[model samples]
Target: MNIRNDQYTIILLLLFFPSLGISQVEFFGYMETEYDWMEVKESTYAFGYNKLRLDYESFPAEEVSIRGNINFQTYHGQTIWEAFDFLPFDSLNINGEAVHSMPISFLDSIYMDNLYINAAFPRFDVTLGRQPISLGTGYAWNPLDIFNQKELVDPTYEQPGVHAVRLEYYINEKCIVDFILSPDTNFTQPSGMIQVKSNVASFDYSVNVARKNHLYPFWEDEDTVSTHRETSFIGGSFTGEISEYGMWGEALWSLSSNNSAGDVSYGLDHTFNNGLYVMLEGYHNSLGAEKDGLYDFHYLNYFSGETKSLMQNYLFSLLSKQINEYVSCSVFIFGNLDDNSFMYAPQLSWEILQDVSLSAFTAFSSGDADSEFGIQNQSFRVRMRAYF
Candidate 1:
């Protein structure tokens, strides 16, 4: 079908059948605007964007429900040096300039971020359509999540949805199982996973096995190419609390026909009586580099979306406190132990009104030029958001 036809069909369905067996409906969303300034070496940059989202949920029946979200965004920016150091290219051009820039105009897209439906039964539930799926216990690194991969630096951000069908079954009061099927290329080559979760004593745990497809860097003699490959993954995670401290751990092993890799991550967090909160996390990837001075053009092209860092070992720490009823402050540090590079980000937020907030943040890096967090020198951001 054509794109225009698909859009028309969706709009018709939304407008013509507003009360198709629906018992209740709810609507909500948010609007946000942000401005950023960045300094990389001798170059300075500016960026700004505004985003609007609309979300709706409806209960069609006692056993059925529907949910969806639509997003609209407009942005304008110019960058003299690249804002992201890990991207495949150096700088992007917009209008005959060696800088990243987007004019202030509406994007030519009415994005449907999520559209899904669910049906529940006594012992099992079924979900179908484009939806978000994530599975893991670790806060910083989620090695066990096979679908909807997340960026560790901004773990709380919302992820895009994927088309899939999922089935969940309850075995008993303490155990449950899930099965997911996601199709690729006309539903012939399907990928999926099986997960079993249980509560043992005071800890909650899950084990998963899956078959998935990914893109990898392939070398043929002197030439390099990005090739598609299939892999099998096995992983598990556990979360528990000891006294006032919370702890979580996750591990994953990936096996291909020719190579195998693994990763592990763990975290600990605590909240004091005075409302001070702190967290620490550690991560290790067997497929990552063990030494410094390894990132180059080829490395950037191969690992842009696959990994966050080239180093094998990493540590993350966060400290946050609520100064008053309307203000809060936080600091986060990310360290690459193998290269001795670190990034520090500090932020302050104020609740301007009941449904509005303002925030300011700054990020700085310390390391040599060749190290991971050193390419992008510093950046600052100010954002305002209103929830409706």
Candidate 2:
């Protein structure tokens, strides 16, 4: 979501020409603004940004539909942020101090986020062009999704669209077969996925297979060529409610040219009668490392958001409560099981008007100075969004 260029906006003017007097056309969007303040061990800095998102939806025919979303953003103080720039600490520890070096330049961009069309056939539905493709049921980590990564701070935020074609066939009322294909030029081969989803008893289950071309994502070297690797994935997930609590689990086995790895996550959530909700989840990655000293471990993956943790095992939990009808509060904690590093974040939100809301959040960490969570900064943010 932090992409700062809009060179490929796809045809902004051409798409509008066809929607001109269409009876089924609809347009809606939102405006969002955010301000952040970070306090490192020695320095305090602040930055802010505002975004205007415009969306369009049209039903040109009974069986055909088109949707598009465009975003315009402006920044203050800084415009381009790389790995760990959101925090005061970045990758490549020169000496032993935290470094915050963000470039300042063109502080605005008009980016097209999504544009896609879908049509219904006799026995199947097809979607083409850039669209959203989400997989897995894990909240903090999604092992089954090889194409996109989630942000630990805002896991529920929208992801950048994938250029692909998707087809879905309904075998029965409770079963479906899905196929997704994307011809990525950066990969040695086209990436694709096949998923079979079904509901059994009271649980929903999915089994999927995917072949993807992956890059190292982020490395400290500036001259690093975009190295690519072909990876295969076999995964499954199940979601259901047993007794009074909700339960879900996802597992994936990854195979590369030279190695094999596995990732798994399990989560449980429940809401009490007193209007309080609690959730707990655990994740393990076979590829992650464990050590009391984090200097040798690569921080690029975590800073670039490919993974949320740098250790092999982790724990996450959340507690939320609703106060009246327009205000709510929540808190979540994440910990690295091996290094004893933990992060605590709390937030409060208020809806003062219809379709508009404001939220405030703060995050701090606890651990040894060189541990995963130790070198982090205490940060605060205030955000407001209004939907039309």
Candidate 3:
């Protein structure tokens, strides 16, 4: 494996952390192997990877603490996984021009997913460096979160840490104000977010505002292009139990020089006394395209980590049950309501032994050939993980 300069920084820091006194430090991590395969019409593509993540936490002083997670991952047989293999489009369009060949850029590098030092004061907390930033209450989708994206196959997977500084000021036990800054290399076009969150009765509520000079790709003048734009967002979210059923919702109004749009998401979930669980959610994006104008959403602003679908309307449902203490299964159904395309995914998980788990997931798509889910015939993925 070839190590780059940035990888060296993470390696050195991990090596230096222990010298400060191992007695006060705690280390934990996990090793995992995952395989994924997909069928698109007559062609099938698959790949597998092994990953090792090590996390460390240390308290340097009464109010100061450090935390980090170093990640090392490698493909099973080959390093490069061609992006075109998964994109719905071909390598070349009708105009004989290459498209959808974007590089993943970081698949081969070993890096720190998170590294941060936090200092707690009497009334507030300050965190600096690369760290995890998450907000909003939607499980499968989060409209109020402008900082990160979710993966459809595994929505709960750990997200990559971002270079940011954060602050939290407490108003009381049930309320707080937060500010976050993600700076740019040029320093002239940075991103910032501020939020005020509070709990009332059986609900938690929050309102937020954010601004960023975002880099986005688009289809303009019949060609593809990428540019930077200054955008602002105002939004709110709430999560709570209503009549013993969990419910949550989020909404965002996105404004830019060219246009303004709104995105909304809401979900409801409940568990029965017999251990059966059910959930339903919906999403609507005023900026999304229609059936006649459908294309890859990855090129749109939402794919920059804002939303999940290409179309303007979508729905998701889930049913899950625990068979025993060590085994559970779930069935999921989601669709692009505009394109009339749907995907059904069933997942099964088993804890075979202590600290070891295995999971299997499979999906089937249904719709017209030109529809979103119809681009893929079927797919399956399997993963095994062990924690230490």
- Looking at candidate 2, what is the lDDT of residue 213? 64
Candidate 3 overall lDDT versus native: 0.79
How well does each candidate superpose onto the true structure, as a TM-score?
0.84, 0.86, 0.88
Supply the TM-score for candidate 1.
0.84
lDDT of 2 at 238: 94
Any runs in candidate 2 off by more than 4 Å, and if so which? Answer: 1-7, 11-23, 78-106, 186-188, 215-228, 255-258, 292-297, 304-308
What is the lDDT of every predicted structure here?
Answer: 0.75, 0.77, 0.79
Model 1 RMSD to the real structure? Answer: 4.8
Local lDDT at 304 for model 3: 58
lDDT tens digits, residue span 89-133, model 2: 554455696556645454577777778888999889999877888
Residue 159, candidate 2: how far off, in angstroms? 1.5
Query: Each candidate: how many clashes?
Result: 0, 0, 0
Off by over 4 Å in 3: 2-23, 77-79, 91-107, 215-227, 255-258, 295-308
Better of 2 and 3 by lDDT: 3
lDDT of 3 by residue, 306-385 (tens): 44557789888999999999999999898889889899999999998899999999999999876777877899989999
How many clashes would you count in candidate 3? 0
Report each candidate's C-alpha RMSD, comma-separated, in the order given: 4.8, 4.5, 3.4
